[model samples]
Target: MQIMRPLYVDPAVPGMAFTYVMATGGGVAQADRYRQDLVCGPGTQALFTTQAATKVYRMEHDYATQRVHLTAGEGAYVEYLPDAVIPFAGSRFHQSSVVTADETATVVYAETVTGGRLARGERHEYTVFTSDLEIRRPDGTLLAVDTMRLRPEDVGGVTGPGVFAGHDHVASVHVVSTRRPAQEIADTLHRSLADADVLHGTSVLPEACGAWTRILGHEQPCVTAAVHTAWDAVRRLLLGHPAPDLRKQ
Candidate 1:
């Protein structure tokens, strides 16, 4: 089955929650499929999340796929903060998300997957797992693209220097704008990022008329927590939202 939701971007939603509920029994049968997507309109703000870790039931041959598409218009902001994804024994899954925003827009996105339920002492033993993310501006201006993958009996490539850099969880926050004084904002964020535990960095993309900040950490929750905090800082410094009312925890 397929599910989709569209919410206005203005006033952003409280706690900005996005959730999905499964009705089928445990373990997906062969050739089964599930899909979900979200869309936000101009001047709108939203945050997307799922109730709990998604499970990929065992599949020996074919892999399941999930595709998400988002649209944010001018002066809008959205965050994709879904819960963890869990792949069960011998299962395979492919995940991809693509987004395009107007010039005056902001996006904070994060995705995480586990080899298996670790509490059950499961190690990395999946057939295949992957996540592909990309974003651009209204005029087809590219901002950033990331592709990550893992397989059974092989070391995951998320730890690459240009990528996750040995961190299990990966996240990226981007702001697209043509406003001047880019240097000033970049400098301030750099100073505020002092002594952060995660390997974090920020860079401005004038060609795309925006900037991007990336954070890598050992735990998924830690990476998301840091992103939430950074959002608060940016809202306070740039958007002028008070500390608590910036982005709901």
Candidate 2:
């Protein structure tokens, strides 16, 4: 694994700082394991993101795994947005991210998944793909959990009415903030993507901590744009500001 020093970016919200550039040393390979831990102190704000898309190469041996642990202290704010993950044929991979934060803390997290290398006509050819995300309060009370265990062969097909529904890319975003109303945030995001070329849904999370959104689109760019729309709405609803361009080259 590789990690670059965090740089302060201009935050849309005053007093909130942002940073970047943590990534895997090399493309993920069979039998590889990666672990990352981040902590945000009280009243601090920061952002974390990967340098590029995570590519899972073909595997003839064991699978690869990545685990992330994050902690946000009282009144802290954090945003974790990683690029999409693309798995090649015969690849097996698993990744999980868990966050523990105080009730007053806020977090915005997102994940994107592509069917495969679309240019190569590869879609849902991976052996196994599993992912899990969880959020908990400081007392260890579970707030939300999102899990996906996908096996194309066993599922008959990865894209269908019940599955991805013919979409080549899928994205999800979660907003956790005690300061705002969850239903309001959900409504805002639902309306934001109503006319988009993507299929999406938004709902409030358990305990009313915040809201969550899932979007599916046939094209990578459309799906990514839809996800960003939801993220932007969340920022506006919670921070009372517009989203800033990440300026990711």
Candidate 3:
């Protein structure tokens, strides 16, 4: 639970501040519980990301859970794009995130999960992994909801047709904004992945709030690149500029 001072690292969007969240412990352990809350003031531009990938160690007893809440004020633009989460064998983890955005604000959120430590041949060896995401207006009206529950021991398993579909990594990006038409946003997202070597899909969010995309790939690099492509496209479309390299080693 540590945070680094915000920096103005994006030349394209000099007004946007970049902040990095760091974990005191090396990774999550059994019986761990964590929570995070992020708020963007009116007309502020900010981007929040983790310093490194989150690792969930093997658990012998209870499970680990994380909760996150994000709020965007009027005319604010916010982005929360954390690194991927990797679960070790026999680990169990759950995460829930809720985003509240004003009618005039815009928000971009992204998340990625791996099958496990691919180098160690730990593919979906975890006991269970789950995540839930909800988007809402300031008045509490819901805009969209996404839920994922993966259990390799289940009957059909997570590698079935509609789920991960045999992919070792999966990523998702959600954009909530009024700067562009929802369909156009979806189109931009779809076109961004056109040349990427991965399987992906895009659609407009409920109530025409924005657009979202889901990507699947066998390797982490490919999946990550696709997600970045989509994010860059959305940035160009909404902010009229390309994404700046955060220079994260």
TM-score: which candidate is best? 3
Better of 1 and 3 by TM-score: 3
Rank candidates, lDDT, best first: 3, 2, 1
Better candidate number, 1 or 2, judged by TM-score? 2
Q: RMSD per prediction, one decimal?
A: 4.6, 1.5, 0.7
Model 1 residue runs over 4 Å out of place are 1-32, 139-141, 152-167, 177-193, 205-208, 242-249
Worst 10 residues of 1 by lDDT: 240-249
In candidate 3, residue 43 scores what lDDT? 99
TM-score of each predicted structure versus truth: 0.71, 0.95, 0.99
Q: Which scores greater on lDDT, model 2 or model 3?
A: 3
Cα deviation at 232, candidate 1, in Å, is 2.5
lDDT of each: 0.62, 0.86, 0.94
Residue 31 in candidate 3, Cα distance off native in Å: 1.2
lDDT of 1 by residue, 1-249 (tens): 323364333253344434333324454444656555566777665666554567787786677887777777777766666666777767788888887877777665656565466567664556777878778776777777767667655654434566545555556665544443556555555555665667778887546455667777776667656666666665555555532322323
Candidate 1 residue pairs in clash (backbone atoms < 3 Å): 9-44, 9-45, 10-43, 10-44, 159-165, 159-166
lDDT score for candidate 2 against the true structure? 0.86
